[model samples]
Target: MNPVATWRRLLAEFAGTALLVTAVVGSGVMATTLSPDDVGLQLLENSVATAFALGALILTFGPVSGAHFNPVVSAADWFLGRRAGTGLTAGDLGGYALAQTLGAIAGSILANLMFDLAAVDFSGRDRSAGHLWLGEVVATAGLILLIFALARSGRSAVAPAAVGAYIGAAYWFTSSTSFANPAVTIGRAFTDTFAGIAPASVPGFVVAQLVGLAAGAALTLALYPGVGQAADEVVVAHDGGTAPTHAGRP
Candidate 1:
């Protein structure tokens, strides 16, 4: 890719991640206000909104930056494609991760401000349990496995809807509500709403997610030994030469 294309891809990653966080945090606030009496209803509403938004974002941005709003996805792409030379390089990985993380923080603040909340109110919702950690591991691992599997099997075209659907289902099935993305976990800590995670709990979630990343990579390799050949097409192929980013799920 040209220098201009690099910048463009970076911009797409930033904007896509920012909007994804906005949807997650914003919808949580809306769900609470709309259904204050029922936690289950709030979760359902939030999950539905997030699923739709995530799929849309992937479709919109996948052509530019692979829509990889999650650091783990980028890392996975690099690791898997290192031998094949088809995924993100080390420098590109760093840039993508930084952009995604900054975008996520901005998104959290945007969502809070839109809902009349403080700009940077750290969440107090404690989610520091062993079971929750286990859930995170499961959620993140499953997510990685799904995306890579789609790539390896030449089915990445359906990743947008498939990834969204998997996340929505994971929300109900996982104990930690499937906060599989480290960027998202950090962003959610900035708001004390229905979807926020406490700042103190962010570390554990991130660690679990990393663990999940490893597990997912192992599973994918075992299932599809030739997955490395499709590393550049993890989520979906893009116009640019680089591998497209994965969906920035919360």
Candidate 2:
């Protein structure tokens, strides 16, 4: 890709990630504020807002940056490009990852500001444990399998809805509330609110997500053999630039 186009894509990733974390943290604060005593109610509110916000964001940004607000998704896209030779370059991967992480942090800060809180307080909620890690693995693995499988099966068009629905469901089913994206996990650490995770816990979640990424890659091969995106389809790049053919699922 040309330098200009690379920067364009990175900008999209950054903006998309910022908006996503804004939704996550903002809605979390809203939910907790509205339902201070009812954990279930808070989860319900957060999940609904997240699902709707995610679906809208994907549709809005997919064309620009593959909507890959998640670092693992970028990694997966890069790995596929390396193997199949039709996706992101290494530079693109690194840039996208960095943009997404920074965007997420910005989003978190924005959320805090909106809610009249300290903008950069670290979370105290310790989410480290075998169960939480297992949940992360399960949540991330399912996300990978769902996204790539959709791309392989020529269903990337439905990813906006499908991916959102999956994450919403995963929120309730998974123990860790489906912090499937490493960038989001890191971003969540910046806020000590209902949606926040302690900085200490971010590394563990990131590691589990990576392990899940590997597992999902293996599963994609075993389950959907020889699934490649069609030429007419693109994951991101609103300018009609080509990105790896995958579900621009974040």
* lDDT agreement of model 1 with the native: 0.88
User: Ten residues in a row with the worst lDDT in model 1?
Assistant: 241-250
TM-scores for all candidates: the values are: 0.94, 0.91
Residue 47 accuracy (lDDT) in model 2: 95
Candidate 1 per-residue C-alpha lDDT over 1-250 given as tens digits, one digit per residue, 9 for 90 to 100: 2233788878988899999999999999999999999999999999999999999999988877888889999899988888877788898889989999899999999999999999999999999999999999999999999998887776678889999999999999999999899999999999999999999999999999999999999998888777777877867676433442333211
- In candidate 1, position 2 carries an lDDT of 22
> What ranges in model 1 sit over 4 Å off?
1-4, 240-250
User: Candidate 1 — number of clashing residue pairs?
Assistant: 6
lDDT of the candidates, in the order given: 0.88, 0.82
* lDDT over C-alpha atoms for residue 186 of model 1: 94
